[model samples]
Target: MRGGVELTDCPAQVSADFGGDTVADTADTRTPAQIEADIERRRAVLAETLDEIGVRVHPKTIMGDAKARVVSNVDHTLGRAYVRVNGVVSEVKGQFVDAEGSPRLERVVPVAVLLVGVVGLLAVGSRRRGGSARRRR
Candidate 1:
């Protein structure tokens, strides 16, 4: 019964302003049916919003999101590692090969000799072990 107008007389007369809160608008010309329809529409929107929130909070949805994040991070880290290793390989290749793609014989020859010597040593060591086992038998 505000200002002699009963609250039931005009439901549209009561309106809420954004931020400013509730502000009565006596000039609102919307009929009861329109107001009812609007309320129903808002209710449906709210129900959909709640359903979406429910899905987002579900355990399976949360775990899936977490797994996606982990996989993305792992991929990013592996990509960085690959780039670093590639750079290292390029530097090593540069050391053993000239800009014109010719092998630096001075560097390559020494490394090749060292590898061959190591392989020969391994082969001799294995033969010695085999001989010792045969002697014991």
Candidate 2:
């Protein structure tokens, strides 16, 4: 193709066979009015393409698309987190429950005692610190 014109075998051979008549001479069969009409049609198509590109690259359109994508991602992340948390809660609940879904007092009492021991240690540590500070002052 040269200057947007495709040189098919018929047209190329015609130019070579007709020696003096160049491709341009044969291709210039369209009248001035027809050429102008073609130009106008091409310009309209180009203008529409440019307008579409402009809309796609516009700041508001870009920002809106980005915001929508972020929202979708955040929603997906939160949904996954919620499912994981629910699964963990169910697993923990199962651990604290028996085969019949009754609370396992044996496991519960031990965990309760461990939590109380941790709290008691924290209270004792804080009291010791406070007492040492008073003595230092």
Candidate 3:
């Protein structure tokens, strides 16, 4: 807690001070442009987090406010909220608790990074083969 203010995972408490939630919902007074931008950013983060977590966020339709979804499939429970644009998510966020019920040790993985690494290795191997064929000649 820097300066005596503590950081917490509760959205309601944080949102209350901010006049409105920038989590589950957008600030109503914010201009449409501002809200749209916020939504866009949130969606990107949500998609990335979900991808990292290795879960499918089934496509859904939403009109204005950003939507947050909570799922409890594993020992961990997640409460994520994000904005949407054009039937697609624009923002995403959540909290995590590991199976051991320990707050400090949460589980997360980098699926996107793994996929990229795998693809990079395959490309490198293919290129190496072509180079070897030329060198043999």
The candidate that achieves the highest TM-score relative to the unseen native structure: 1
Q: Tens-digit lDDT track for model 1 on 1-137?
A: 33332345444555444554456567777887888887798799999999999999999999999999999999999999999999999999999999999999999999999999999999999999999999998
Candidate 2: which stretches are off by over 4 Å?
3-42
Show pairs that collide, candidate 2: none
Candidate 1 accuracy as lDDT: 0.86
Which candidate tops lDDT?
A: 1
Q: Compared with the true structure, what per-residue lDDT tens digits does model 2 show for residues 1-63?
A: 333444353312222333444544364566678668877987999999999999999999999
Candidate 3 wrong stretches, greater than 4 Å? 1-27, 55-137
TM-score of each: 0.74, 0.67, 0.22
- Total colliding residue pairs, candidate 2: 0
**Predicted candidate 3 versus true structure: per-residue lDDT over 1-137, tens digit per residue:** 22233224323222323444433332345666765786788799998998865544334423111243222422133222222242242122223334464442222345456778999999999999999999999
Candidate 1: worst-modelled 10 consecutive residues by lDDT: 1-10
